[model samples]
Target: MALQGPEELGEPVEESEDLDDQDASSISPAEEITLPPGPGGDEETEEALLLPWDRFSAWLHCICVVGFDLELGQAVEVRQKYPPGTKTSICYLSFPDSNSGCLGDTQFCFRFRQGSNRKTSLGCFLETTDRDAPPCLKQGHYYGYVYFRQVRDKSLKRGYFQKSLVLISQLPYVTFFHSLLKIMAPEYFEKQEPCLEAACNDIDRWPTPHPGRILTLPIMGVVLKVRIPTSYDKPGTSQLVQSAQRLTPLIVVSSPPPPPPPPRCFYPVFFHLQMLWELVLLGEALVVMAPSPAESSDTVLALVSCIAPLRYCSDFRPYFTIHDSEFKEYTTRTQAPPSVILGVTNPFFAKTLQHWPHIIRIGDMKQAGEMAKQMKVKKLKNLKTLDSKPGVYTAYKPYLNKDEEIIKQLQKGVQQKRPSAAQNAILRRYFLELTQSFIIPLERYVASLMPLQKSISPWKSPPQLRPFIQQDFMKTLEKAGPQLTSRLKGDWIGLYRHFLKSPNFDGWFRNRRKEMTQKLEALHLEALCEEDLQKRIQKHTEVETVDLVLKLKDKLTQAEREKLPVHPGTLEKLRAHIEGVILTLPEDLQGILHKPTTL
Candidate 1:
């Protein structure tokens, strides 16, 4: 992954800013394990770096061993290893309690929202959980990734050995970590702790992950090729790695990568594709029932990613079981289900979560070629008749009509024997376009809030955003709504109204408002800089001049403090103008301005 030696992992460095208070709360204390020095390490160096623990903690918060306990008659975390830190309770997370009782081996992913008890700590370079609403900048919701594996083991009492090697990273790199664990977990089970140390050492050598670039990550001798997503990326912009091995060793497909996993989940529910997209976008509480943990997690993850670019503010768990800590909290019939998407393999959930509005019951996925012929949406009772077949079960109607064009396109691809990757790309692109169409009207209306540049004045405070009126915005949407670009048309206005009530809308609106406000401030600064500094100073009295300078200083300070989106060149030019005005002033006035500090 890199030319750097083992010493790089041990080198003392400050903790990354990305690992904020909320993330640290999920990192519980594990028994600290001491290890021998690296190739050329000394006692002081080992102490400084924390050795393999530091290496492991760099990419993973901790390594957990969760499996069924025969003696306890329940699933329990057998052992866990965490870096040296103040201990905190991980009770907030509802870890899966039962193993996916499949044959040889199966892998899947799960996500959980850590409790609201925010705690602060140093170290751990976890990415912000939701890119749209960074926990460090916004609320204290941290999401954890559980990469689970279950192997059939006759030696064990349950006839299977199952455990999850969890990564407490805020990053939603579902596919990447699954591949890493596929390689490491088997070795971990075979060789135990030493294997973990070796894998961590390899991870420590990986190059820093950056968007729009292909990253080559190595773990336990397997190499992974992945491309991180940039803000400008559209769906189908990146292709999934063509891994040679069935057990993907090192493929990290972050951001809009379309292929194998998500498409596979959709194949069984292909007819309800558009409806599934709407459900995810509307933040509906969805329950996915599959035959195993592998399918359950994959399906849920796929559902969550359907409305990407527009973050799904609601929480989701890929492979949930009745034994999870939140099982009762979620299954309680009295209260309406929370805005969450849950995936479960256990048939018990079919009855337990029957009250949930939307339920997707999918059987084991057939090969893409085999599934091509049976792509049809079957209508069924929500829960009473779930046992009869595999299809979408819901009473809620979709806002938009089914896009017959997309259906035809997918069908055409299937008939042509197009590769599964191509079909996936088509689906991904459709979702991306649908989301764009949905957001376009909102974006246009928001853009109108900015006042004309001529009205901005250096003497006046930054202009306020014209308040957003829902009714006014709706009226304008008559000519320009989601239907402007969308092929499917229904109550486009209704979709927008429903979205306004969602957390995603609130988060998006706040972020956009803040950004616009910053631009307004920057514009004011630019207007001030355009004036002749000497002429402005000469017109005002000494006191007025001093006050003006102070105001300018304050504006500049605030912009810098907030890290406003102003051009550096403009800021520098403004600073130079302010300095010129100060130097030209009378000695007494200069002294007053100089008393504080230079610009």
Candidate 2:
């Protein structure tokens, strides 16, 4: 069973055992008291006696505590003391070692006071096997402890009690001592600064102190002492003590290293070259215009020579020439005003005379002549001739007479050939009528049938009528009457005689002329009707061709719509087809098809 401490009881024992006791003791009358020897023989001396709070104080001070096993001969014997006439009850209190074992080396025994008289009460006893058993005692050790007590104030009518204790342990006396000093005596610790450096030096000089000689220091205004195992610097002392003294405390607070310098910004080399060129150009310009003649000449020559080398530099040449030309033109034109040059024999100084009239004395001829010579030698001319011959026109006369003769022959051949459609139609309609009906006279046809020629005599006519008579006619007429001959020779008589002789001819001519006029009118009507019918057929054919084209256009539009890929289900396939179509299309057409489509 575990042993209980005095704090659990309502009274204190009158008698208690010391380190010489080995058995239980009788109780006494006092409320708080120490103990004397019991029935057991005094096997352990006071030198080996461990204080009640030794292990506890050692742990509180962060000192290492040694552990032991109860089964391995590690145990503490305890005996309780209680008062007379008290129905005493024993309770065991056990404290576990730093090891995981169950209260192996630590134990306490308590005897509780009973009966109505509360003054005669309880007692406690504590002991360690380390004193009696060689295996239980740890070597090179320090210990600390805490004890709890319930004290009654008899002066008060009512009694109250609470727990209190003192703790003590061994620690390295160093700069860190202020922390432990504060815990021990906060008021005193606050009043005085701890001599940490001196104490640390002392600990370095003397690492181990004498054991069992408890060193007392105030703990919260109460005096307390703690025991520590002593270590020697001699040959047999453990190295663990030296290792602990040499241990260096680590500090973790540190500052971050400085950041790396900002990177440099580097512009490209071409930028430098460009700036250099510009500066050189500006310097050259300033040098050329410097006031001194020797200086200006030297500057101009240097600049020109410098630029001359760069003439083969493709890009530099054009730019330099442009700048040079512009500068020269500006300087020259500014120096010579146009108004001063109209009738001036020497235009070079005209501008200088007009603008800086006071400075332009006639004595500046040498400068003007030098300038003029420079201009003549260096100026670009406007009349730049081409390296090619002039163009010439060669004469070409056509023979008009031969052309006219050829045209006339062509016209004659056309007229002699078959007539054209219009000419044929006109001749068929009016040729016979015009030649016969219109040309023949109406009176001649009517008079030709009369017998005037027989009625007139051939010999009784005037002398002019004799020329009309042939020799055969006169011989035939020799036996005839003179009236017959005169009738034949007379003008009116000849017409009547001819009409009587050719009566059948007059009738046939008149009938043929009338028939020709009637046939011509009929042919004109037929030709006009045929032409009208041909025009109507041509118009109908044109209408048919127009209708066919319109139908073809409609069909083509329908086919295009059917082939369009607007349907929802075939979108993917349509896209592929469109890509193929684009590949097959001409570049111009493909540009149209590949254009972005809006939703």
Clashing pairs in 1: 224-250
Q: For model 2, how does the per-residue alpha-carbon lDDT over 439-533 read when each residue is reduced to its tens digit?
A: 23322343333333333332132111111222333243334323332211223223223322332234334444433333333232222222323
Highest TM-score scorer: 1
Consecutive 10-residue window with the lowest summed lDDT within model 2: 254-263
Q: Can you give the lDDT of residue 272 in candidate 1? A: 76
Residue 457 accuracy (lDDT) in model 2: 31
Q: Report residue 547 deviation for candidate 2 (angstroms).
A: 99
Q: Write the per-residue lDDT of candidate 1 for residues 473-495, one digit (tens) a residue.
A: 99988898776798787877788
Question: Model-by-model lDDT, in order?
Answer: 0.61, 0.24
Q: Which candidate is the best by lDDT?
A: 1
Error of 2 at 257 (Å): 56
The C-alpha stretches of model 1 lying farther than 4 A from their native spots are 1-58, 73-100, 115-149, 152-158, 202-253, 256-260, 263-268, 365-382, 411-418, 539-550, 581-599
| Candidate 1 local lDDT, residue 37 | 17
